[model samples]
Target chain A: MKKIFLSLIFLAILTTGASAQVKMLSLPQLQKRISNPDTVYVVNFWATWCKPCIEELPYFEKLQATYKSQPLKVLLISMDFESKLPAVKTFARTHKLASEVYLAQRKSDQELIDAINKDWSGALPGTLIVNGKKGIRKFQEQEFTYDELNKLYQTNK
Target chain B: MKKLVLLMLIAVSSMAFKLADGGYKVGDTAADFKLKNVNGKTVSLADYKAAKGYIVVFTCNHCPYAKAYESRIMDLDKKYSAKGYPVIAISPNDPVAEPADSFEKMQELASKKGYTFPYLIDETQDITRAYGAKATPHVYVLQKTAAGNVVKYIGAIDDDTENTKADKVKYVEGAVNALLSGKQPQVTATKAIGCSIKWKKSA
Candidate 1:
């Protein structure tokens, strides 16, 4: 019984540490991820402090689950400041965000926002759906519902 | 005759759609709105009879970006109000969507911050929609012309959204100063990362 309890605690710590691992990526690296021809990338730009971004996160999660069989990738790219990396990791772990999460490794918000999409106004909750194989891309700078997200994916796919 | 009428209808509808997509672009005349201020009075641009122009800012209490620029906004009002340009802040977020942005909270924040400018409530969000405000702290510097209120600038208050306030390009102030000096603003617009406005659910 003692051995089992000790192993369980160790396992819990491992999982917690694993979940807290958030990758940091530059704009070019992120663009490369989206350019993967085999996968459809639904990259969502959000921050832990943004309420609307948090509100629309579940829809992205649902999209990931619904399209699990397909080569659909939902990337939650956090725009939180570099100083807030610990907070981003904590948020990812607490939310149990199964999707691959990354923090933007850019110097200026303007550069990243413009590179992602010129139409974007550097607002939180920005979403970009890209199917590199099909050469289809859509960007929206607003909160989205599950239906809207799913429809965008399907249409883009 | 029927085909001509149908063609005209399509053209009109397309024009309306384009208008809906855009709000007041630079040089476009801005519309006036009567909104309730935190002091329990209806405030309008027309009410400021002595004003030469207006600095219309769509901001809220809850947004971190807006909070960061609070002092800067107050400073703008203080510096410009006596010079015939006043800052008019409007809370554009729906109260139901964001309770922290409600009217009472606005009044509370205004009193707490000792804001000299009129902090108004855009209850229906129609004023915000008309202005095409996408985020909190979005500013529209309107110059009162002989024709009407012309949008001289539309964008972030400054380049520094993180409140470092160092080496920041003050967009709104630049626009206002240019107008004051009888020259067009060099930088008419700019973008900054900000919290999206909490829009109400459409029924």
Candidate 2:
């Protein structure tokens, strides 16, 4: 009974550790992730403190689940300061989000914002959908619903 | 011919929306506004008869980014109020959309922080819309010229948000200083990661 209990605790810790890995991405690294011709990447720029971003996050998760079998990736890139990484990790863990979570590593916000889309004004809840092969890059600096996300993904396809 | 005219009308309206979305650019004349201050007084940029310019900042109470820059913004008012470039902060958040940014909260924050400048509420949000303010702590430096308040600069207050750097560029200060010295700011605009201005439901 003691062995079984100890192993269960160990298994829980292992799973938690695996899921706690939040990748740090700079502009170039982020660009590389979406460059794959076979995969469609939906990169969402958000922060833990942004209410609107938090509200619409579940929609992205739903979109990811609905397209799980497809060559699509949903990346939630946090715009929170790097010092707030612990808070971001806690948020992702507590929320149990399935999308790939990343912390943006940039020297300046302009570098990342302008690189992604010139139309973007470095606001929270911004999303970018990119398909390298299709040569499609759509960006919206606003919150999205599940149906809207799905429709945008479809239209882009 | 009827279809073409209808299409032209549609195009014109859509173009107006687009123009509204892209707020005030540098060198453009900014319109003055009558907004209620935290002190329960109706204030306008035109009310400051002795002022030469204004450091109009669109900021709010709850945003983490705004909270981080609160002290810095106060310092801007302190250093420039005597110089005629007083900081006039405007809370542009919709109270319905963001309850923490209501007028009461704005007054609470102003008193708690002991703000030196007038912290005003853009009640109608028409001023915010006209200014094209999109983010909290968005800075717009205007110079009182013969034509009117000419926007000298727009964008971030500085280069670093974390406030950890010793050599960070102070964009707002530079603009205000340049205008004081009868010179144009070398750096006119910048971008920073900020909380979006909470628009009312219809907006």
Candidate 3:
């Protein structure tokens, strides 16, 4: 029984260390989530290769943890090329990113960029803080400090 | 006091909006700059007196998107330089933020690639800011006019970022071709997913 318990613990550790499975999200699916009235969605467009995106990830994770009880959901959308899915998965696992992560599936980069925000200019590390309830939609194409992110949530919430 | 406060709010909101909408629009005349090139020589748009126009590309060594488009940029220079539109690449990323984009690394890459065009370094990023380049591989095609260099096209090199050879609509080529044919480019501006310009931390 003790050996079995030890093995279970080891398995649990391995599973936790592995990256949480990521789902493929179409533009429509992403739009639906962003437009949902019940929840405040903090959608971060990132890629495994973007340095600033990687650097600013912890802030998003902190936002997720702080608002665990609230209706705030942090969605990390990986903009890595579809062919680099393995790299994306590896990056998520290596970073041990806790929030819900996804790989974007779309017809083209232009379509995706336009769908997200016309002014985005297709830059990585772009963030969208949307509170459908308050009709508050803010988009920034730069990295945010944890304090700035917290303040954004407080103001929007 | 209420009127003053209302004006202040409007000003603040407008400033915020402008910050988000930063960068050059199509038809805006872009400025010229004297920047250090990889060949240990200073380069400027005016230096190319023989050329009728320029293909100014903001690209770097570090970004994957930039790397993927390297051959295409070289090809653009090769095909068009003699035709009076030479490719002038600028590394716009702050070296402090992205170590790989430092001048030395740029030199190494240029040597390895045997780049025919000048690869200038936007060290202070003043040129980048002036041109409003938000991402790596951002392109601006300028046509020389009686007044000055007129911005004919601004944006991505092509429609497809993944496969350059497979791209159906080569935006840069199309814009340049249109210019050569004495017609306004069908598509003046475009956007593609790319690494954001690595900016220096502001005090």
Candidate 4:
């Protein structure tokens, strides 16, 4: 019984340690994952500190579930620090989100800022809707409903 | 009838150049607003009536673009305030949404950076909307004339995006110099690119 309890404690600590580190996404890795010709990629820029981002997260989850069979990929890219990777994973697990979660690990904000959009002013709670073939549309805001999200997809398409 | 329709389309397209509703025009008397400054004291635009003009900048704490212009803005205030164009910086971001842009934190930054100008906070964001400010580091140069306060120039601080060295044009500074020389501003408005000011969510 003591051995089993020790193993359980070890597992708990292991998960906790894993949760704290942020997963950084390289540009090449991002390009590779999102380069699918069939999918319309919805890349959301969010952080735990942002309330509006938290509020609108469930809508993205719902959108993902609704279009699971479709060629739609919802990628939730957390702008949180690398050290907060574990906490972000916990947040994702707690919220029961099915969308692909990524930690955008850039050394400087400017690096990601220029990569996303030349016009991007580096605001949180931003989003990038990429057709992967046509073009990209970026938004800087806190809250957006499922209807708004749908409208963006339709208009872009 | 086709000619008339084309004329109407052209006229409608030109109308986009004018200020939006409730926005400050070239000759509108700017309404006075009391905002908490970096010093923890209230500062108003009217208080600078002693000056010939004002360099009103809407900026925030968290935006990287805002940070880029921090020193340049200070320098502009320092150089121009002596020449009668004082700079008044306002932060329009909601404190609850952006804690770094809160009043107390603004005060701290101003103190630490030794800001020569008033870094004001638009608590309700009314001042921001009045100026039609869309991004951080957005600039509006107003010259107090016998007629009223005339907006001389409204746009980006300079031509550089992220690199200060890349700045080839000084739009606001140039307009201020022209105003100081009693000449009409050459460029009235240009597109401003920066972080969008965060407005408070309706309860």
lDDT of 2 by residue, A1-157 (tens): 9999999999998686536568788889999888898998999999998889999999988888888999999999999888888888989888887788999999899888989998887879899999889999989988888888888899886
What is the C-alpha local distance difference test score of each model? 0.89, 0.90, 0.89, 0.77
Kindly state the fnat score of candidate 2. Answer: 0.73
Segments of candidate 4 deviating more than 4 angstroms: A1-147, A154-157, B1-22, B25-28, B164-167
Candidate 1 per-residue C-alpha lDDT over B1-203 given as tens digits, one digit per residue, 9 for 90 to 100: 99999999999999866765677789989989999999999999999898889999998999988998899999999999999889999999999989999899999999999999999999888888888888888999999989999999998888777767478888898999999999999988777788888888899
Residue A119 miss distance in model 2 (angstroms): 1.5
Residues A16-118 of candidate 4 have per-residue lDDT tens digits of: 6423333569776887877776678888888765556788888887887887787888889887656668878888777766677888776455567667776
Q: Model 2 chain A — which ten-residue stretch has the worst lDDT?
A: A14-23
Q: What TM-score does model 4 achieve against the real structure?
A: 0.60
lDDT tens digits by residue: candidate 2, B1-203:
99999999999999877766677999889989889999999989999888999999999998999999999999999999999999999999999989999999999989998999999999888889889888988999999988999998989999899899999999999999888999999999899999998988883
Among all candidates shown, the one with the greatest lDDT: 2
TM-score for each candidate, following the candidate numbering: 0.90, 0.92, 0.90, 0.60
Put down candidate 3 lDDT per residue, B162-200, tens digits, no spaces: 883454689999999899888999999888999899888
Q: In candidate 1, what are the lDDT values of residues A1-157, reduced to their tens digit?
A: 9999999999997786535569899998998888888899999999998988998898998899888999999999999887778899999988888888999998677789888888887779899988888887878998888888888888888
Candidate RMSDs in Å, in order, are: 2.8, 3.1, 4.5, 7.9
Candidate 3 local lDDT, A56-141, one digit each (tens):
99999999988899998999999988877788888888788888899999888889998788888888989988998888888888
List ranges where model 3 is wrong by over 4 Å: A1-19, B1-21, B164-167
DockQ of 4: 0.10
